[model samples]
Target: MLDEVTFDIERGKIREFVLATHAGDTVHTSVEAARDAGFPDVPATATHVVVAGHYRDQRAFVAKLGLAYDRVVVGSVKWTYFRPLCAGDSVRGVRRVAADTRKRNLRFVTLETDYLDAAGDCAVRVREVLIERGAQ
Candidate 1:
């Protein structure tokens, strides 16, 4: 696993992410609405971590794995949410290469990132599949 990355999920970022993603849920944008819905604060939208990921520069790790940006294509992304993520939560995530295989001219890589909440409980897990095409 690569070194852990930490991010504080803030309210403004959550609201921005919700607005940018066109998430029409009031709970994701307003703390009052979220609290009314039983959340401590504005709840992050699904996949909001993708925005938080910007704080961690994973490009170096990807380059270390020999993945050329031009050759890599994101195959799929899967997220398993174990608990609601709300604004003001500080999360830590560890990323590792879960699998790698080559078939014909295509190389498939599975990267997994597991995130933990401040209480050290699992919050979310993200699995991303990347396909790299060999030069003809």
Candidate 2:
């Protein structure tokens, strides 16, 4: 893994993210609604895991990877969920470079991050593709 960081999943954060993203799902904001939906508590939306970045210094990571910070852009993202991430969950995200290659005039870097729950089980896997422009 290239780096790792752990953070708590708070109810308020989940609610705010739900509202900000217009998820239109009460289960993401209301514990009671989530309970009714068979969840232990308000569950975070899939993309909410992106908040993990706030816990780390991404610029340092980019520098460590030798990637041009100004030229790097997110190309795509994929998420695989193994279990629901709830409001009180504390997850540790482990990041690694899955692939790196140059095609034509662009450099493509594939990064994979696995969010592991408190029990050490992977709750989600995020695959992100970053493209660096003018890297040829």
What ranges in model 2 sit over 4 Å off?
none
- The whole-model lDDT of each prediction reads 0.87, 0.92
In angstroms, give how far residue 14 of model 2 lies from its true place: 0.3
What lDDT score goes with residue 18 in model 1? 74
TM-score of 2: 0.96
Q: Write the per-residue lDDT of candidate 1 for residues 9-121, one digit (tens) a residue.
A: 88998878877889998998777888999999888889887864686776777687788878898999999999989888999998889999999999999989888998898
TM-scores, all candidates, are 0.94, 0.96
lDDT score of residue 115 within candidate 2? 97
Model 2 poorest 10 in a row by lDDT = 127-136
Error of 1 at 71 (Å): 0.3
Candidate 1's C-alpha runs over 4 A off are none
List pairs with backbone clashes in candidate 1: none
